[model samples]
Target: MYQYTPFDRQFVHARAAQFRDQLERNLAGTLGDDEFRALRLQNGWYIQRHAPMLRVAVPYGELNSAQLRAMADIARKHDRGYTHFTTRQNVQYNWIPLPQAADVMDKLAAVDMHGIQTSGNCIRNITSDALAGVAADEAIDPRPYCEIMRQWSTLHPEFAHLPRKFKIAVSGATEDRAATGWHDIGLVLRKNEAGEIGFQVRVGGGMGRTPIIGSVISEFVPWQQILVFIEAVVRVYNRYGRRDNAYKARIKILVKAEGQKFFDAVAVEFKNILERDLDGSAHLITQAEFDRVNACFVRPAGVVAQPEVAAAADLPLAYRRWLERNVHAHQVAGYRAVTLSVKRAGQAPGDVTDAQMDQAADLADVYSCGELRVTHDQNLLLPWVKAADLPALYEAAKAAGYATPNIGLLTDMIACPGGDFCALANARSIPVAAEITERFDDLDEVFDLGDIDLHISGCINSCGHHHSGHIGVLGVDKDGTEWYQLTLAGSDGSNHAPTAVTGKVIGPSFAASEVVDAIEAILDVYRAERTAGEKFIDAVKRLGLEPFKAAANARRTATARHSDTAEA
Candidate 1:
């Protein structure tokens, strides 16, 4: 984790104080609601459906045990007894009051955290792989680069307010767990023919009403010039991006409208910035600075590998199941990364109780390296757990309600805080997610179903990244009733896939009550149609939507016939 320096501390505290003053004035009638809207939004305070929601940034999804404990404290003291982890690796308190917003900011600043740049139409949090440094297939640790961008992007004067909210993601591994294809700017680190490491820059990729995979503008950019290139991309969007309509203001719209011309313009702008040194800050990012940032993330030590214990045949079936689902391979031989599943049965997909957060911090201290990484899938990662201690860790996790043994299964769905919290949402996402989890609670059945990425979003803002799911469900409002539109064969980031594809709509939308049935029908079709050893997404791609649609309609017809027969 990046430690906050004195200057960083001062900057955050000062910002918190400034916001406190702004809030006080607004309460005192010096500032109106309209006047304070932008200020509140930039600070991550949203006037949501029922109350104010505060989104606290977890930079690159990295936080130490102390910070986790602080978050728990905030959750316990202020809002409800739980907090919601977002798809972008941030945490939100949905029940916060307007008067206590500044107080929450002060608490976050106390732990070297803040809500700055978390919302509004500016560059949001720079996210990367949850297992960035620990992943076995990593080309390089992407955290250093992510941190550099985090420092550069936060409250950037040149891009304080873009036409729309922008996101950037970086991937260090062959497996793109960071969902690089769906970001405004996606950087994949790779070595050139000469073995010099650089970035493959993809721009204008985003998910919303108009979802599109980004275009590769630059094949390879040297490490030192990354900031300059990013600036150039944002500058082009700022200059030409649509501002007349909020829906058309995103960089993806500009990219789609202009085609290759946008890429060409970015190249020209990048060259101009590089040649003229438009910002003197670009020169400050030399190898020494990179090294300095990299040095902060030291590899964990004192790991003792107990091969016998790890390989024990006498291990409990529960522990083995958890090992298979929750544990992941690590870059270091003796260590493993463990994902704590927050998508347990009968709960909101990403909701975690304050007590659970405290317990997680304690477990991190005991088994992990006293740090945790928040996954894009709305889970937490203990990135440096010894393989030998996994059994004990699993036991502890189970007791703390962290061990669900459903990491990548159908039950482990990605969802957004929808109509329950957001004013923009058309339907409630929590109930939908809970119903799905309850319907597919059997671990054996989920395992048998195999590697299905199910995602649900309340609306078309795509906050849940539904377009990336193998089975995507988007809630819609039609004639005052909640309905769900289904999409199939979508994927996020993957080196295995031919290309990352946005899910296509299957057919008509289903009523809220029929969603689970529709999902089950789709799964039944998959089980019957899939070839041996085929993953769910691959099967969907191979077989297409026709089979699934037929099965879904069949389920509906069967249910209607059964109802008629019972009535008779």
Candidate 2:
């Protein structure tokens, strides 16, 4: 994890104080609600359905034990005794009051965290692969670049109020766990045949009412000029992006409207900007700066890998299941990245209690070099877990309610805090997620179902990244009744061409009560048609939607008949 510099500390503290002052002015009647609303939102405060929600940034999904403890404290003291992690790798406190919000910001600053740039129409938190440094198949660790982008975009004056919110993501791993293809700007660390490091820059990707896979704007931009290319891209979008309508404000929509002209425009701007660097303004990046950031992320000393032990053979079946599901391969030998599942039965996905948070921090300190990472799938990761310590850590995690042996199975789902918390939501997402999780409670059956990414969003906003899931479920309202629409073959940016696939709608919407049944029907088709090693996404892609559609509609018809007979 990157340690906060003295200047970084000062910057965060000053920003907190500034917000506190604005809060006071608003309470004093000097600032009206209309003006204060924007200011508060810029500071990551949202007026939710029940109360104000404050989102705190977990930069690049990295957290130290001290920071995690601070977050737990915030969850306990100011709001509810739990927090909700989002798809952007940030956490939200849902029950915060308006007056206590600034105090919350100040408390966060105490632990070197803040809410700035987590919301509002500006560049948001820069997400990277949770296994950035640990993953074995990565071209380079992307945390340094993510940190650089964070420093560059945080409270950038020119970009404070864009037409709409913008998001950027970077992934170094071959597997696109970071879902970079669904971001406004997606950077994949790539090395060319000449062995030169650079970025494969993709632009105009997003999901909402309109889902788009980012187009590769630049084949390769050298490491030194990466920032220059980003600046050019954002400048072009800011200058020509639609501001008249919020619906068409996203860069994806602008790119769609302009077609190839958009790419050409960006190319021309990039060339002109680089060509006119008389004072070398465009070349802000340097080898020295890269080295400085890289140094902050180097592995700690006195932590060499140990030889494998035979004691693993004596572990119980439950412990073994957890080990196989949650523990991931690492770049270093004899070490693994352990994902602490927050999606236990009866609990909403991604919701972590304060006590669980404290326990996670303790486990990180005891077994993971005191560092943790947050995954985009809304789970906590201890990125430096020693292989030999797995048994003991598993026990501690189980006692703390973090050891749920369903990492990538049907029960391990991603969901947004929907009508339960958000004013923008059309229906409740948590209850649906809970129902689906309960339906798939049998671990053996879930494991038999195989790797599935089930995602749920309350509305078309796609905050749950419903478009990126292998089984995407979007909550919709039809004539005041809550319904869910299903889509198949959605991806988390792991396709062959470095792009994402927006899952196609499967069939007609189903009632909220029938969501689980609908999913079961779809899964039934999958289980019947899939080959030995076919993943859910691969099976769906190969078999098409007709078979699944037939199964789902058949179930719907049966349910309708049962209802009519009961009425008679």
Candidate 3:
């Protein structure tokens, strides 16, 4: 994690005090609600349908045990007993009062956390692969670059406010864990034929009302030129990105309006401006700076696994499953990336209690090199756990409600904190995620479902990444009643698939627990008909949505089946 420099420290502290003054004035009636709304939003406070939601930035989703403990303290002291993890790797407290908002900022600053750029149209959190340094497939640690952008983008004068919110993601591995394809600017670090690490810049990719996979504008942006190139991209968006209608105001719209050929020409012209005028060339991260950032994430030592833990890892069945799913190799030898599964069958997808937070912190102290990462998939990651200690670590995790043993299976779901907490949500996503978990309690059955990525969003912000799931469920309202819309063969990363709306389930709004069974039922049909060794999405892609859709819609009551709620 990047420690705050004196400048950084003063920046957040001063911002906190400024917000405090703004909040005081608003309370004193010197500032109106509209005035305070912008101020609070820029400071990352949102007036939700119920309470003021506080979004705390967990940059690149990297947090030390101490920071994790601090968040647990905040959750326990100020708000609810738990916190909601978001898609961009942020944590939110849904019930933060406006008056206490500044106070909360003070508390966060004490622990080196803040909400400074968490909201607003400014370049939001710069996310990277949660498995960055530890992933076996990575060519470089993307966090250093993420931090570089974080420092450059936070409260950037050029991008303080945009036509719409802009997001950027970076990936360091062959696997696109960071969802590079769906960001305003996606940077992938790659080694050129000359073995020099550079970036493959993807632009115009985003998910919203208009979803498109970003096209690569530059195949080889030399390391020294990354910042300049990035500025070029942002500047072009700023100059030409739509501002006419808020709904169609994202960069994706601009990209669509301007074809890739035009975007390329414009980006080229913009890059020349960055090279000639802006001297970001000097600020490019040097080797020494990279080493400094890398030094703090030192590999840990020591591991003694329980006999049964070793046995489990050695089991031909269990070991192979664990290796394929649980173990991701690290850049450091003798260490492995361990994804701690909190997304269990029958559990809320990303909900963690404060006690569980402490337990995770403890695990990080023991086996994980004193670090914890919140993955975009709504799970916690102990990035560098030793292979030998994985069994014992797994056991500790099992006891602490951290071990679920389902990573890519049916239960490993990503859902947004929906209507329950968010004013933008059309329905409740937590209960929907929870219901599905409850119905699919059998680990064996979940595995049997085999590599299905099911995502649900209460509404279309796509926070749950429902837009990118192998199977996505979107909730929509028909009249006053809430109904769910289904999308199939959609994927977030890896040969990315655009979200597909399969069919509308006709029936009374199913209980949250029942949705899982409904999904299981849909998968059962796929398994029965799928060809050998086929993953869920491949099968769905091989065979269209007809059969699965038939079975899924069958559970709909006769009245619900024919109702006008069906959107497709």
Candidate 4:
């Protein structure tokens, strides 16, 4: 787990004080509403529909037991007891009072945490693979690099007010677990023929109204020049990227307008300019600095071998099923990665109460080194548990309602905060999510479905990662009513390709429960007709949408035949 340095702790404390003073002035009528609005955003406070929302940076999704416990306390004390984990890997408290926002920051600073750079037109928290350093395939840990980027980007004076918010993702492997292709700048640690590690850099890929996969602007960025190259790219974007139209502001638009060849040439020119200014403006990265960052993430000593986990071999058939489904690879020989599922049957997806958060921290304390990682899919991950204690860990997770074992199954869904809470949504996404999970009660049925990703977004911005889901559902508002638009074959996987629109609006704003039934109707047809070894997405691609859409819209049979399973 990461411990805050004295300087880190003090920095947050100072920021909180700064925000507190600003708030006092604003409320006392010394500061205008517009002035205070900008200042409050600088401190991660947002005025949403119902109340102020506070986004707390988790710092590459790594935190300690103490930090999480503090989060639970802060939520219960200053805001709602429920916190929402976003796809960006930060937690948002939706019902914070504006007057108490700075106080919330003060509470966070006490635990060496802050909400800085979590919003506004600034660099957001740098993200990496959630399962970094512990996947079955080996790569250098990406967290240390992500942390370095976080430090460099935070409050960066030069790029503080860019044309738009910029996002960067780093991956440590061939597989794009961090959505590297959909970020302003993406780095893949790579080894050259001489075994020298550097970075394979891509720029200009991002998502919004216009989604694009980044192109490789540099095949090989020397190890020492990583940060310098990134700076050059951002500099170019800051100067030339769109500021006229919000939709056109992302670097992707710049790349699209410039053409790939032109974009690559300009980037190369920028890289050359930086190299010439190495001693002046460019401080090339060094092995020592990398080592200094890497030191922060070193694993704890004496990772105990859990020989007693052999008891798992003698467990009931269902326990064995859970052990196989939820457990993942660990870099350490004796340890295993544990993903605590929040997707219990018939529950809202990606939600955790203050109590649940506390329990998660407690689980981390006893089994691992009081550490946790939040995956993009909204599950808590204990990354360094010993294998021999699997049975005990499993039981503990079950007792605490954290053991659903449906990490990537059909029930594992990504849904946005829709009409229930979000001001922007026209339809509710949570109940639809709950409906789908309950409908797929049989694990064997879902396992056979194989690697289905269902992502729902209440609107076009695709906050739920609908562009990445194998089955993408978007809520559209037509004349003050709700409607759903479905897309098939989309993915956020290693070689993900965006889904093609199925083009069948099954219902002109179907009722919440009816949508789930529509999806079930479609799945039934897939199961009945799919070729052996074909996944749902694969079967859809192999056969196309006419059949699936028809089955879902089979209204005559919908009532008696599981109507709630219709297109959730």
TM-score each candidate: 0.97, 0.98, 0.90, 0.92
The most accurate candidate by TM-score is: 2
Instruction: Give lDDT tens digits, candidate 3, residues 437-484.
Output: 777777677777778778888887778777778777777766755667
Task: For candidate 2, give the lDDT.
Answer: 0.88
Better of 1 and 2 by TM-score: 2
Tell me the spans in candidate 3 whose CA falls farther than 4 Å from its real position. Answer: 274-324, 344-347, 495-518, 557-568
Candidate-wise lDDT, in order? 0.88, 0.88, 0.77, 0.77
List the lowest-lDDT window of 10 residues for candidate 2: 491-500
lDDT of 4 by residue, 395-463 (tens): 999999998767777788888888777777777788778778778888888877766778888877777
TM-score-best of 3 and 4 = 4
Residue-level lDDT of model 2, residues 1-568, one tens digit each, is: 7888999999999999999999999999999999999898888998889898899999889999999999899889988899988888899999988999888999999999999988899999999998999997877999998898899888888888888899999998889988988999999999999999899999999999999999898889998888888888888899999999999999999988897898888889889988999988774679999899889998866567768666546778888888789999888888889999988876788999899899999999999989999999899999888888898899999899899889888888999988888899888899999888777878889988878988999999999889888888999999988999999888887532234889889888989878888899999998889999888788887998899988888998888899899999
What's the residue-level lDDT of 48 in candidate 4? Answer: 69
Candidate 2 vs 4: which has more TM-score: 2
Please give the distance, in angstroms, between residue 110's alpha carbon in candidate 1 and its true position after superposition. 0.7
lDDT of 3: 0.77
